[model samples]
Target: MKLVLEILTGVLFVVEVGEGCTVAGLKDAIAAQEELPRDRIIFVLEGDPGRTIRRGEDGVPIVELGFRHGSHVYLFLEPEEDNGDDP
Candidate 1:
């Protein structure tokens, strides 16, 4: 199965994985392909807040999240928190 992912930076890429593949596996693949840090990436279903897939839920298979071949998903960077010390 091929999953199309659109990053926050407006970059789009396709990952070839099986339906049985876990979200964690996908994340690892994305990180390797983009040469990014896994901790900095987040995955969410396009236009669906309720379907946000967190790193903790990586064990869940892609099909379990309602994703099929050629599905399009959104990738965003984990937002950085603003500390009060920032002036």
Candidate 2:
């Protein structure tokens, strides 16, 4: 299945993975493709918290997590924290 990953900074990535791809696996793939650390790339499903996608769902398959083939995910890039708090 293919999914759209739209980074918070306006970068976009269309990734193709197996039906059993877990959230962690997807993040790793993106990290490898973008040459960034997996920990820095985060995916979040907006709206209600109950229905939102969280990092705790790492081991769950995206398909079973209600992610469609063309699901649009918001990828938040969390850079390392510094002495100064800046976005």
Candidate 3:
């Protein structure tokens, strides 16, 4: 299945992956293709009340998430947390 990934930077990437690919697998693929860290990638379902797809969730396939060939998903980078080091 070919999935369309729209990064937060307004860049679109098309990746060919199996239908049974897990979210983590998709994340890894996106990370590799985009040369980014997997931990920094977040997938959001595009639509009303867009929800963040957690990478830790297992057993759920991309097909089950309504992702089909040419389906588009929003990819947002996980923001860095403040360490509270500022005075």
Candidate 4:
């Protein structure tokens, strides 16, 4: 399955993998493909900040979560404003 992950005001990356690709794995995949640093990447799932979402009470890694086939995950580049314009 190919996961379509898009970041607001940034880039949209696609990941092709077998079944059972976790969110955390997806994150690593994106970083690898985009040549981005893991420390500065964040994913937003279901409209909530990925950092705030819990995998098992603790904050979850973007790679460890489950994604539906053809599902799209939204990622936000850290250190960049959600809105491009300065406040």
Q: Pick the candidate with the highest lDDT.
A: 1
The 10-residue segment with the lowest total lDDT in model 4: 49-58
The superposed Cα distance between candidate 2 and the true structure at residue 29, in angstroms, equals 0.8
TM per prediction: 0.81, 0.75, 0.80, 0.57
Per-residue error (Å), model 2, residue 38? 0.6
Model 3 bad stretches (over 4 Å):
84-87
Model 1 C-alpha lDDT per residue in residues 1-87, reported as the tens digit of each score: 998999878899998987689988888899899887777677778544447887688788888888888888988878776777977
lDDT of 3 by residue, 19-65 (tens): 78988788888878888878877788776766678656645787777
Error of 4 at 44 (Å): 1.7
Badly placed stretches (over 4 Å) of model 4 are 46-66, 80-87
lDDT of 2: 0.76
RMSD of each: 2.7, 3.9, 2.2, 6.7
Ranking by lDDT: 1, 3, 2, 4
Q: Using TM-score, give the best candidate's number.
A: 1
Candidate 3 TM-score, true structure as reference: 0.80
Steric clashes per prediction: 0, 0, 0, 7
